[model samples]
Structures are given as C-alpha cells and as structure tokens.
Target chain A: MRRLAARVAPPTATFLAGTLLAELLIRALGVSPLLLPTPSAVARAAWSYRETLLPALASTTGAVLVGLAASVALGVLAAIALAASRWVERAFYPYAIFFQIVPIVAVAPLLVIWFGYGWRAVVAAAFIVSVFPVIANALAGLRSVDPALLDLFRLYGAGRLARLVKLELPWALPSLFTGLRVAAGLAVIGAIVGEFVGGGGLGVVVLGAMRQQRTDLVFAAILHASGLGLVLFAAVDVIGRIVLRRWHWREEIP
Target chain B: MRGSPIVGLAVLLCLVTAACSRGGPPAGRVALALNWKPEPEFGGLFEAQRTGAFRRQGLDVEITGGPGAPIVQMLAAGQMAYGIAAADEVLVARDRGADIVAVYATYQTNPQGIMVHASRGVNSLDELFAGEGGTLAVEPGLAYVKWLRKRYDLSRFQIVPYGFSIAPFLAEPRMAQQVFVTAEPIAARRQGAEPKVFLIADSGFDPYAAVVITTTQRVRERPDEVSRFVTALREGWRGYLEDPGPTNREMHARNPEMDAETFALGAVAQQPLIEDEFTRAHGLGAMSLERWRVLGEQLQELELLDQEPVAADCFAAF
Candidate 1:
C-alpha cells in the first residue's frame, strides 16, 4: 500500500492542483467558455456525450491496437533481417528513416486515395508513423549483442535461429519495449491524423465539435484521446515489466 | 538593478517594433481574417484591397488568409476588426454566445453543394441519398448534414468525412462528396470529370455565403467605419464582377497552389452566386430578416442551435 501510494501521489497531486488553479483562474478572469472551458465543464461534457464518445473511443482503440501490432510484427522481422546483414540495413534503413521523417498530414490525402478511406487508411497512418521507432530500437538492440555471446553460441554449434531465440531476442526485449512505449503514443496521434482525412473515430468527433465551436466538447474529446494514449502506454509498460522483471539487469540491482 | 537597463531597452525595442509593424496611413488600419485561403470565393475583398477601394474609404484593411479559421471567435475576442463567414456560421456563432453580426454578404446564394459523377444520372439529393448504397463524403457535424439526415433516409449511404479533395471523388465512381460550387466542381472539370452538382440551397437550406462580419460592439461604437467598409466592399464587388483580372492575378500570387486557370475558373463560377436577383434589387451584399429567421428555425429544428436566434441580432444589413 505504501509503495503504491508513493507511486500514485505525485501525479494525482499535480493533476488536482493544476485543475484547481485553472478553474479558479478562469472564473476570476471571467473567461468565455468558447475560448476555454473549465475542467469541470469538460468533465460534464464528456459525461453528457458518453454514449457517442465511448463508441468513438472504441473505434480509435481498435485502429491503434491493429496498427501497433503490425508495427511490432513487421518492425521486429525487418530488424532481424537487418541484423543478419549489414547490406540489408544499408539498403533499407534510409527508407525506414524516410517513413519516420515524412509528415503524416502531407501523406494523409494520398493514404485516403490508396487505402480508400476507412479503418484501412487510419490503420496505415498509425502504422507508418509508428513503425520507424520500433525498427530503429530493435535493430540497435539486436546489433548491441556482445561478440562474446555470439562466439559462445557458435562454439555450442547454435545456428542463427537458435542463437536469436536463445540469446539476442531475450537481450533485445527491454529496448524493444522502449520503442513500443514511444510507438504506442505515436500510434494514437497517427490514428487521429488519419481520422482527420480518412474519417471515423474521435478525430471526427474533434473535427465536428471544432466546426461547431463547441470548445467544451472539443476538450472532452481531447481528454478521451489522451486517456486512450495513457491506456496504451500503461499496457505497454505493464507488459514490459512482466517480461523483464525476472532477468532484466535493472531488476537484479534492487 | 544592473539587468533592469537591458530589460528596459528590450521593452522599448518591442514597443518601437510594434509601432513600426502597425504601418499605414493615419486611418482605421484594421485586419480582416478570412476563413479560408485566398480564392475567388473572397474575390470582392481582394478586389477592394487590390483596387484601393478600402484605401479610398480611408480604411486600410489587411486581409489574412487561413484554412477554416474560427472567424467568429476571433472577431468576438476583438483579435480582428472584420472576418468572413457564412450566414449560417454567423447564426451558429451567435447561438454559441459570440457577439458578432454579419454586415455584408458576398455570395447571395450559398455555393455549398453535393458533387456526383455525371454518369450516376442522379438529379436531386433525394434520388442520390435513396439510391443503392455508396460512399457520400461530407464533413461530419455540419448542420446541413444533420438537416439532410432528418429530411431523408440516408441509411443506404456510407457517410465518410470529406477531406477537401476531389481526387477521391474522381477515383471512386460511386462516391458523392460535398463541394463548394466554385471550387471542387471546377477542379473536377479540369481533371476531365463532368460532375453534376446538386446545390444544397435547392433543398431549402440556403444561407448567404462569404459574409463580412464584425463584433456587435464595433457596430455600436463605430457605425461610420462600418458603413464606409460596407460601401467600399459593395463597390469592390461591382468592380470584380466587371473584370476580375487584376484581383485574380494578385490572389494567385498570394496562393500559388491554385494555378492561374483554376483561379480564372473560380472567378467566373462565383459571379452568378454573388450577383443574384435579391442583390440586384437591394444593391450588393444585401440580406433579409426573413432569411435569417428561416435559417435560425431550420437550425433549431435540426437541434444544431439551442434556440432559434433572433433574426435581428444575427446581422446588420447595410
């Protein structure tokens, strides 16, 4: 209980303090709700529009999960291939960086044209924005394997697959999770951008509310989007903790 | 204490810079924020700037372009002295507690419509919506979309969000997307697609488009300035209708993404919408109480507005 409280206290205190200050400042300044809604107003709007917002949340969640999964699967496979050959990395790594650097907004229209506007385009957006981090981090981890370990595996007559499964894969787990944590957040952003052009999900909700000038509802939708991101981040963190708790160097320290 | 001199110098420099940036003749130097980028949709406003109509009126107007800017909010907050918006947008803004009123209307008829492939052979909104299911690209949460849903059974159609591009519509034969009559339709034609447009106005949801709006406070405080601005705008529009060559060239330079041909097309397309029978009789940028009341009631029916806004409060017809 003490440990959990210590972990929870700071964030809770900061959030509460920030909300209180904002509420008071808005009230004191007589700020228009159109310009800025009080936190309570946003909460109220969220609750009032729960039926609509919840479904939108689920839709966005589906896109994020699918996109993240694709990113992990493809990213890991590409990283493994790159690790096997320096020529492969040299040939493909620039394109991976290109995907990362290309602005999602600029390509979103083309995504709609190619993917035909729906979950496919949205998922593609999420995947493109997110896959680079996973590849970069996983390749770094796979490459960082100690030469001594490779020699040991070779001496034991282990082949590439066996060595990767027994040695490099386990070693790269922590780095892969770091990439996942970053990708999880990016997937949400990409999904929203996709929805901006491709249609569907909370991005549509945000766009609609913005057009109508419902700032309170816009804040509510944004809060829901952030909540989705947090959930994804937390899920990744929990998975990482579970995987790494037994053998990770950090776990062995304390 | 030693750092105070530097801070003071900085503050003085900022003031000097601010004053220099506010350069113009000693008159009412005001800014007009456009809801969209420079297009012939705002030809008259551009014409006013290019032809010195605003200058002649002793009002140096700086027109800033944006992509779907929150004009009503900006005006209500006094960030800009004038803005361009649709009449329905002005009513919606007023309903949301924005104290902005439309002063002059550029497009007497709203240009927003649905673009369907000519091959579809669809004549009206009803036939299109009730036909075999296909994608209909529209901006979600628009009051007109809600009105259409209420007025027709749109269950057959898959409504996707419109991304302000005609490429999708051109690529998909079954797709019908919302368009500004002067914009996407023209682009579609240029790309070798003959699209049949069904104006939303024909469906009895018409609202004046490209209306010049300002705060109610400004109307109350500076009536002469408002009058002069409206007069200049009317003259500018008249000048544009006669020959939009200069304004189109200037606007094209400002918005290079739109090629010269596209700008010329838009200039020709918006002429009929700007100069209608009502505008002909009542002079340019004319508005009516009945139109506002009808629009407010329609919005109220659609539940887009909390209540039917008073028609009088929505605009001041000059």
Candidate 2:
C-alpha cells in the first residue's frame, strides 16, 4: 500500500500544483502569450503539429529500437568471441578504444556520406555509439569468471560451449547487465545526437524546427524525444531487474 | 592482419556502391554544397542537373545537403569546387579570412521578409511599431534583428525569440513573424490563412541570399572550367524559368516528399526575384560589385563584421 502511494501519487500532485502555478504566473505577470506562451498555447500547438510530431515520434522510436537491437546482438557476439580468445581481445581492444575515442560528431557525417542518409545511417551511428559500453562490460565480466568455477564444470567433462552457457555466462550476467543499462541511456543519446547531426528523422526535425525558429513545435518534438528515451530506459530497467533478480538472486523491493 | 585489410576493403566497396548506384554523369567529380536541405528553393539547380545542363558543361556535380556542416572549412579543404553562401556571410568570411568568391545568384531577391496577420490592423511599419500588444517574432542570430533594433525602438514591442515553425504564428492569431516568402508563405497558404508580408529590403536592410560561391584561388586557377560551370548554371536557371518540367521530375525523383504544386510555385516565385540591372545587364547569375560593396558597408554599419569580407568579385570575369 505504501509502495503504491509512493509510486503513483506524487506525479498527480505535481501536475495539479504545476498547472495552478502556471496559470497564476500567467495572470500575475502581464506577460504576452506569444513570447512565453501559456501551457494551453503549447498544448494547442502540439495538437496543430500532430502530423509532424507523430511521424517524428515513430521515426525516433524506430531508430532507437533498431539501434538497441543491433547493439545487443553485436555486443553479445563480441562477448562470446572475447570469452573464447584473449588474443582477439588483446588485439582488438585498442581499436575498440580507438572507435570510442573518435567523437561521434566526427564520424556522423561520413556515416551519412558513406551510408546514404536516413535510418540506415542513424541506426549505424547509434549502434556504433552504444555497443561499446555493453561490450566493455561484458568482456570484463567474461574475464571475471572464477577459475575454480570453470574447473568444477570441466571435472564433469562439460565441454567448452556447455561450460560457457551454464557457468561462465550466469557468472557474468550482473556485470554484463550493468554495461547494458549504461548503454541503454547512451543508445537514446546516440539516436538523438546522430539525428541532430544528420539522421533526417525526428532528431533532424526537432533541430530543423529550432534552426528555423519554431520553438513551440521544437519543444513539442523535444518532449516526444524525452518521452521516448524515458520509456526505453524504463523498459530496459524493468527487464534488467526481472532477469537479474532471478539469475543473480537479487531481492525484490516489495 | 590480413583479414583487417579485407574488412576495410569491403566497407569501402559498400560505400562506393551506395553513392554511385543512382548514377548520372561521369565528368570530373565535383561537389556543390548548399546552405540548407533539399527544399523547393534549390529546385532550379537540381532541375539544371536533371536537364543535363551541368553535364553539357562537362561537370559532374554532387550536391551535398547542409546540416551544420562547416561549409567554409570544407571549401578551403578543397572538398567542394563551389558552395552556396549569402553575400553577408561571404563578407564576414572574407574579413575573418576565408578565400572564397561569389560567382552566381540563385534567388535575385533574398526573399527574407517579416510576416503578420492581416487582422492585426497594423497598416505599415509605424503602425506595427505603435501597437503595445503585438509580439515581433525575430531570430536572435540573424543579422537583421540588430537592424530592426537599430532602426526601431524594439524594447517597446514584445519580442518573441523565433524558433522556426509556422505553428507559433498559426497558434497565436495576432502575432507577427519573420520568414522567407518563398518557403513559409506557401506553407501558410496551404493552411488556409493568407499572411501579410513586409520585405526587409523595402525597410532598407540589404544583403543577398543563396548566391553560389567558390574560392577566388579556384576561379583564378581554372578560369575556363569556372566559366563553363557558370554558363551551364545560368542556362539551368533559364531553362528552369522557361520549362522546369524535367527538373521538377528529377527533383521529385530525388525528394518525392515535396508536393509538385508547391515545388512548381517555389520555382515560379523565385523567377521575378532575379531582377535588378546587375543581372539584367549581363545575364542571369550576375552580381554587382557596387551592390556587394554596398552590402558590405551595410554589414559593417550593422557591425556584422569588423571589415569587408571579400572584394566585389561578383562576376567570374574570365
């Protein structure tokens, strides 16, 4: 009951308080509605540009989903490969660092020029930007496997693959997920920044609107992008909590 | 080590295949950069390419869309043989030390204008200024905001910092805005509202917009090539005004999102703007040294820069 009150009630109170304050401020200041539009004006603007707003939301979501999926796939595969061979990890770590070191801004245009605009370029940029954290964490996790744990599995004649699936991976899940959560926030940033620079999606639209001096619609798009990032982070957090709670014996709050 | 080379090669191969698959001509490779995106304003140049005007001049043009690209750096680095820059920008750049020149005029008029609602009952500049309730939508970075303040006591008028959207203007019925007549007015008309317009030019602020630019060094080195490019570009504009059919089809092909009517309107609107004796005397794609110098002087007065940016190198007199 306390958890329910804690989780569900503050936002309602805040929203009501916020509305009262906004209306009060509007009436108090003699401020022209055009320069600093009332919340109602923003809501009306939101309704007006629903056409532009909805597509941009869809575009940004699509870019983020596609990027996250790509990151998960590549990040897992890199973990597996690195788990199998230290030589590969040693040889490629510098290059991985190199890719991370080169600012995404520097690489974004060339990605567009090379990949030819729109979702493909945006996805590539996001994937490249976000996977590093997951990879770095997963690699560290794989290396963190207890020597005695490996030997215990091997004593039963467990093969390399089975030992990896059952023993090494379970051992690595907590650290790996830490990387993924860090990557989760970064994936959203990657999509927005990539689009800001050149992706031609909602990020582009938000930026274009701002450049053209359409702050109302720009803020509306920003709200959408924020809602998207928040939603993604929440979803990932929930999944991480569930998976980690069971796998690593993490306790549930309630 | 060996596999790395192969992987690198594969990436390059993919990039080349992506860039070249929608193939056109095979002249010496050249990149023409824009001040902005694939808007209707750029249709003439694209139409020129569609009509084989650039090809006839033995040029292979790769038009890059501008999105926060540091255009002058790219030009100075020899990435693009030609770039589009406003005359005011050209002046600031020259003063700040970028070696570029203006070779062509895309829009005869800059098309930058202040728009208001007809119902505002503000008959002229004086009336607009007199009103206590009106909000003047102005962009902060644009040079003209200062010009407006210098000429008028803007402290009295409620100034709304512009963030480019028609929604703000549409949201508030009585508000005034700054926008290009070619782009925003069309968008407004589509929304079933006729907008009142006042040109900054008429208000005594002078500068050019969407003028084709190149390095002065490149012009000196490849005079004939530059001449060929300019001549073809001029022919492109003429053909755009005369027919614009093939160009429209090509522009549609490249960016199908732009509607045909709006595209045609944008093209047609830009035509009357290409007047003034400078272009009239020589041909289209003409600029006046006197005009450039005058704009430079205004920019200096406006204090856009500390000094003049480029010599009045308007026409590429090869």
Candidate 3:
C-alpha cells in the first residue's frame, strides 16, 4: 500500500496543482470555450470513450510488440554482419539515412495505397520507425566489444560463433535493451500515425476526437499511448538490469 | 400586397435593431479563428477588424487563422471567442455533442476545387474522376474521402492525401491539381504548372469554406454580441469586395513565403464567387437549411455521415 501511495503521490499532486490553475485560467478569461479546453474537459473526454479505447490500445500494443520483435531480429542480424565486415555498414548506412530523412507522413499514404488498410500497413510503418534505433544501438554495441577480450579469446583459438556467443552478445545486451526502449515508444507512435493517416483503430478515434474537439477522448488515447511507452521502456530496462547484474565484467565495461 | 401585420412588425423590429445607435456597451473581447492561411479568402474578417466595425457593435475582435481542427479545439477549449470552420465540421462536432453554434456564412459558397494536369488528356470533371494513374489531392479527412469513394468509383485512381501543399502537383506531371479555387491555382501559375481546374462547388459539391461559428453557450449568454459579430463580419466582407487594399500584404506577412501576384490573381478569380447573389440577397452570415439538408443527405448516401444529431440541429438562424 505504501509503495502504491508513493508511486501515485506525484501524479495526484501534479493533477491537483494543474487543475486548480486550469480552472482559474478558464474562469478569468471570460473567453468562449471554442478555443482552449479546460483540463477537466480533457479528463471527461478520456473517460467517455474508455471502453472503445481499450480495443485501440490492444491494437497499438500488438503493433508495437510485433514491430519491436521484427526490429530486434533485423538489427541483430545486421549488427552481426557489420561486426564481421566494415564494408557492409558503409554501403548500407546511406540507405538508412535516406529512409530517416523521408518523413513518415509522406511515405504513409503510399503504404496505405500499396498494402491497403490493415495491421500489415501498421506493422510496416511501425517497423520503419522502430528498426533504426535498434540497428544504430546494436551497431554501437557490436563495435564496442572490448578489443582486449577479443584478443584473449582469439589466443584460445575461439571460433567466430563461439566468440560472439561468449563475449559479443553479453556485451551488446545493455545497448540492445536501450535501443528496445526507444523503439517501444516510436513503434506506438508509428502505428497510431499509420492509423491516423490510413483511417482506422485507435488513431481514428483520436483523430475523430480531435476534429470534434473531444479533448477527453484525445487525452484518453494519449494517456494510453504514454502508458504503453513507459511500460515498454520499463520492461526493457528491468531485463537489462537483471542481465547486467549477473556479470561484473559487463557492468565494468559500461 | 402581402405583408401580414405581424410580419411587417417583425421587419420593423429588425430594421430598428439594425439602425440602433452606434455606441457600444463595451463589448466582450472575442477571438475569431480562421480557416487556412490569411489571404483574399479572409478579406471580410480583416476588413471588419481593421475598420473597427466590430468595435462599433460592442466587440473587441481578435482574428486568428489556421486549419479546421486546431481552430475548433481552440474555440471549444475557450482559448478563442469565436471562429470560422466548415459548416459540415460544425455539424459533425455537434453530433458528438460539441456545443457549437453556427452563426453565419462567410463564403456564400465553398471554393474546394480539383484540378488535372492539363497535359494528361483530362479536361473535364467527368474525365478527372473517370479513371486512375492520376493522383487526386484532397483534404485529409473522412468527409471528402467518403464522398469521393461513395459518389464515384475510384478503383483505377491513386488518391494522394493533400496537406494543403502545392509541391506534389507542381513537381509531378502525373499529379492532379487539388486546391481551393481561391488559393491553389494562383499558387500553380507561379510554379509554372498551369493545370485545367474543376471547381467542385461549381460542379456539384456544396462546400461552405469559412463559416462563422460561436459556442452554444455564447449564443445563449450574449445574443447581442453574436448579432454584432455577424453584422461586423458582413460589413468587412463587403468592404473587401469593394477594395482588397493591403490585405494581400497582410497575408504575405503571415506567410512570407507567399507570392503577392499569385495571391492577387486568386483574389481576382475568387471575387466573382464571393460577391454572389447569396450574400447580396440573403445577408452575409446566412444559413441555408435547404443546403444543409442536401449535404446531410448526400453524406448519409456516401455512408460517411457518422451518427450525429441531425445536421439542422447544429445550426441556427439569426
């Protein structure tokens, strides 16, 4: 109970302070409600569609998880290739930069056109947004393998696969986890943006709420997205901490 | 020959109110949010504001210009006092129980027009909507997309969502021109991508671009304020039609990237539409229950009219 109270205290206190300020602002302005909505109004909007929002949350969650899983696999494979050869990263880095510069808003419509409306398009968008962080982080992790350790393993005539499993994978875990945390949030945004553009799911609800000035629903969707991002980031952090706690050598390298 | 006594009295009351003394009772400060960038399109609001006509009617007016969603959010949240939005959007919001009241019409007509790359052998509306490979630039929303999907079979065409940017149409030959008859074509000529255009409103779309809407609470609390805002807005619109003056310069100041001549041409092209008999005959901030019903019915047929209160419920006549 104390833990729960400690956890909940800050947000509750923040809300009390914020609401007091928001209400005072609204009353003082004598302005029409056509422009800036009150905090209470935003809360009400979040409440009104909590039921429908649950399903959208589920869809977003599914997209983010699937996107992260694919991103991790692709990133790990690329990191392995880059660790083996410098030429591959040099050749492919420009292509990655190209995709990075191209805004998601521009490519989303074409994805909708080619893939039609569904999770497939959402996953593609999420993947596009998520893959970069994992790749970039994993590349850094792979290259950061302690050269002295690599030399010691090479002295024992360790095979490439043995060296990777014994040394590289463990060292890369923390960086890979960091990349996962970033991917978690971005994947959610990409999925929602995909839906916002392509028209469906939680994104449509948020867009509809936005159009009609339903601050409550917008807040509700946003709250869920933020919560999901935090949860994903925390989950990755916990795993990293647990794994990193096991070895002094890995902890010392950082 | 047919003026009923009661009707005549009502007219007399209206005239008396119109001719009431110019001195204001210290009007409340009201913000007027805009639809799209400030240009010849917003001539009336600027005119009323600049001429102090709103002040005459007991209003301290602030004019803000932006797209439909943000403006509506600002208005509903009480950051703004009053605003203009698509009449259909106001109705849609009302359906969701967004307490908005449509006060008057800014454009007697909507200027949403679609254009084709003239070199693509598409010269008419029928040709533009007939087949595919040509991208149709449109506002990113359900109303227009649903209408296009329901009204016409667009299986062969690639529909590119528009962000109100002209670059897509200006650069690509295969791209169809999508613009407000008031804004985009003027932008096109400067870019040297002159395309044959089809005005949807002229063809068969009843789009009201800049509609003056107030909060329902505002209507109930200060009927007098709403009336003055409308009158002032109408007066300003009338002034804009007579002489645009530095309105283009003001618009350019808002978006320095905008070309002055292109804006002027857009105004010239738009003047014929803005000064139509609708505003001249009915009054500037007029609402057509008839047109609203038509849009509602058409939207329903398109299957895009999400369940809301009836279209008429979202609006009122002054």
Candidate 4:
C-alpha cells in the first residue's frame, strides 16, 4: 500500500491542484463557458455522454491496435529483406521516406476513395504514418552486428539463416521495441486524423460537438482520445519491458 | 535637446493630440463571423461591407468566415460581436447557458436536403424511404437526421458517414447524400450527374437558416449598435437580391473554391427562399415567434431539449 501510494501521490496531487486553480481562476475572471468550460463541467459532460463516448473509444482503440499490429508485422519482414540486400534498399527506401514525409491529411481522402470509408481506410492511414520508424530502426539493428561475431559464425560453418536467427534477432529486439513505442503514439494520432476525413471515432464526435457549439462535449472527446493514446503507449511499454528482459536472458545463455 | 523648453512644449502638444484622438473613440469596432466561407450563403455580410452599410452606422465591421459551432462559441465568449447560426443551433446554445439571441433570419426556409441520382428513380421522400435499404451518406446525430427519424419511418435506409465530399456519391450511383439545396445540386450538375433533390423544409419542419446571432449582453449594453447591425444586414440582403453581380464577384475573389455557376445558382435558388411571406410582411431577415414556438415544441417532442426554452426569449425583433 505504501509503495503504491508513493507512486500515485504526485500525479494525484498535481491533478487536484491544477483543477482547483482552474476553477478559481475561471470563477474570479467570470470566464465564459463557451471559451473554456470549468473542469467540473467537463467531468459532468464526460459522465453524461459516456454512452456515446464508449463506442467511439472502442472504435478508435480497435483501429489503432489493428493498425499497429499490421505496421509491426510488415515492418519486421521488410527490415529483414532490406538487411539482406543493399540493392533492394537502394531501390525501395526512397519510397518509405516519401511515405513518411507526406502529410496524413493529404492522403486520408485518397485512402477513403481507394479503400472506401470505415475502419479499413482508418487503418490504412494509421499504417502509412507509423510503418517507417519500425523499418528504419529494425534495419539498423540488423546491420549493426559485430564483425567479430560474424567471423565466429562463419568459422562454425553457420548459414546466413542460422546466424540471423541466433545473433541478429537477439541484437535487434531492443531497437524494434524502441521503434514500436514511437509508432504506438503515432498510430493513435493517425487514426484520429483518418477519422476526421473518413469518419467513425472520437474525431467524429468532436466535429459534431464543435458544429453544434457543445464545448463541453468537445473537451470530453479530446480527453477520451488522450486517455486512449496513453493506454496504448503504456501497453506497448509493458510488452517491451518483458521482451527486453527475455532478450537479456537469451544473451546470458550464449 | 532632451530637456529643452521647445522639446517639452512639442511633447506636451503631442500628448494633447493623442488624448484628443483617443478620447473620441473610433467607430465601435465589431466583427461578424459567418457560417461558412464567403459564398452566397454569406453574401449579405459581404454586401454590407461592399455598400458601406456598417460604416453608415458608425461601425467598422470585420466580416470573417468560420463554421457555425465555432462561430457561436466565439460569439458567446464575447470574442465576436455577431455571428450566423441556425435557429435550432441558437436554441441549443441558449439551453446550454449561452446568452445568444437570434436577431435576423437570412434563409426564410432551411435549405438542407438529400440529393439522389435521377437514375435511382427516388424522386420523392416516400419512395426514397420505401426503397430497398441503401446507404445515405449523412453525419449521424445531426439535428435534422434525428428529426427526420422522429418524423418518418426510415428503417430501410442505412446511413453511412459523409465527409462533405461528392466523390463517394459520384462513385456509388445508388448512394443518396445530404446536401444544401443551394450548393450541392449545382456542383452535382456540373459534374455531369443529374440529381433529384428533396428539400427538408418541404416536409413542414421549417427552421430558419443563416440566422444573425449576437449575445444578450451586447443587446443589453449596446442596443443601438445591435439594432444598427441587424438593420444594415437586412438592407444588405435586399441590395444583394436586387443585383448580386459586383458583390458576388468580390465574394468569388475571396472564396475561389466556388465558381461563377455555383454562385449564380445559389443566388437564383436563394432569392425565392429569402423573399417569402414572413419577410415580405415584416422585412428582409424577419422571423416569427409562432414559427420558433412550433420548432421548440417539435424539438421538445424529439427529446432534443433537456428543458424547453421560452421561444420569445431566443430572438429579438428589430
């Protein structure tokens, strides 16, 4: 209990203090609710609109997870292939850079046109924005293997596949986790942007609320989106910690 | 030179001149936020600026473009002097503790509607509803959509999301999409698709559109300014209806996304809607309490309102 309280106390105290200051300042200044709702008002709206907010949260979270999974799988495979051949990297890496440089807003409408609306288009948007980091980091990890280790594998008559499985995979795990942590946050943002153009998420709720001048609901939607992103990032961090621990154990075994 | 008598005298004269100028306030600087870009939907405001109607009232008005919800938010926050919003939106805003009052109604009838391809053979509302269930691209939870569901039996149609794009509707011939009666039909025709339009106003649920809104604080504190703004807006509408050529050219320059044909179509479609019986009886931008009452009652029945607002309190007649 003491350990948990020590961990929780700072954030809880900070949040309470911030809320108190905001409430006092808004009341003292006679600030208009339209400009910025009081924290209590936002909490009320969040509670009242939970029925609508829950499904939007589910839809966006589902899209982000599916999209992140696709980016990881495709990114890992492409990195392995690119590590094997300099010729392939020279020919195809420019396209990956191009994809990363292109803004998601410019591409979301085109994705809607091609993939036809709904979650498929949203996933494509998420995938487009996040896949590059995974590929670049994983490729660097694979290529940065020690020359002495390569010589040892060669002396043992180890094939390329065997060497990659034993040596490169272990070496690449930490870098891959680093890329994924970055991509996880980006994937949530991509999903929201996609939903702005394509529809069906908290973005839709925010847009509708803004149209009707419901500032409270708009803030509530934003809060939900931020919470979703935080949850996703935390999940990725926990998974990374577990995987890195195993990778360290495997290194010790050798 | 810093402390000489001549320098002191010059500085004194400068301060006196500055005080005189500052003491006599310049024309009350006001900003009017419009519902959309400077299209015909907002021509009255542009017309006001073009013809110096606001200047005549001792007001230097800045007409800027924004979406309806943000415009209302700005108006309620006292960031803007006036804004354009729908009557339903005003009612909602008022219910949510925004002290906004609607003073003018530009579109005497709501111009919102659904457009379907002529080839789909859905010419009328009943047929469109009774036909085999197909997708109608509309934003869910819109006031109109909720009202439509309450007013009709529309279980057959499945509403997919619409993001203000005509490309999806063009790609799927069977799809019916929400559109403004003045805007989308012209764009559709230009794209070589003949669409059959159904006006939401024709269904007898007529809410005012492009309503000129201002805060109750402004009305109470500066009633004269509020009155002048509303009157100028009315005159501006009348002037635009008489001849929209120069005013529209100026608007097109500001909003190049709309071309000549779209502007022309909007002017033609909006003229009849603007000069209806209520406007003719009172003046341009006139609204009736009876109509607002009916709308409020309907909204109450639809459960859109947590508590019914007194309709008279929602608007101020000039």
Model 4 CAPRI rating: incorrect
Query: Cα miss at B51, model 4 (Å)?
Result: 2.1
True contacts kept of 1: 0.46
Model 4, range A1-254, lDDT digits (tens) per residue?
99879978998999899999988876776656655678888899899999989999999999999999999999989899888889999988888787578888767778888987788988998898889889988888898888999999999999989999999978887778778888888898788878866778886787666655566787798889889888887787778777777546432211
What tier of docking accuracy does candidate 2 attain?
Answer: incorrect
On lDDT, the leading prediction is 1
lDDT of 2: 0.68
Residue A39 displacement (Å), model 1: 0.7
Q: Give the chain A TM-score for each candidate.
A: 0.97, 0.83, 0.87, 0.91
Expressed as tens digits, the lDDT of each residue in A23-142 for candidate 3 is 777657643333334667666756666787888788888877887788889878877877677888888776765644667756776666566546777777888888888888888898
Task: Report lDDT (Cα) of residue B186, candidate 2.
Answer: 77
Error of 4 at B285 (Å): 0.5
Global Cα lDDT for candidate 1: 0.85
Best TM-score among the predictions, by candidate number: 1
Model 1, residue A111: C-alpha shift (Å)? 0.7
Instruction: Judging by lDDT, tell me the better candidate of 1 and 2.
Output: 1
TM per candidate comes to 0.93, 0.53, 0.70, 0.90
Backbone clash pairs for candidate 4 read none
Q: In candidate 4 chain A, where is summed lDDT lowest over 10 consecutive residues?
A: A245-254
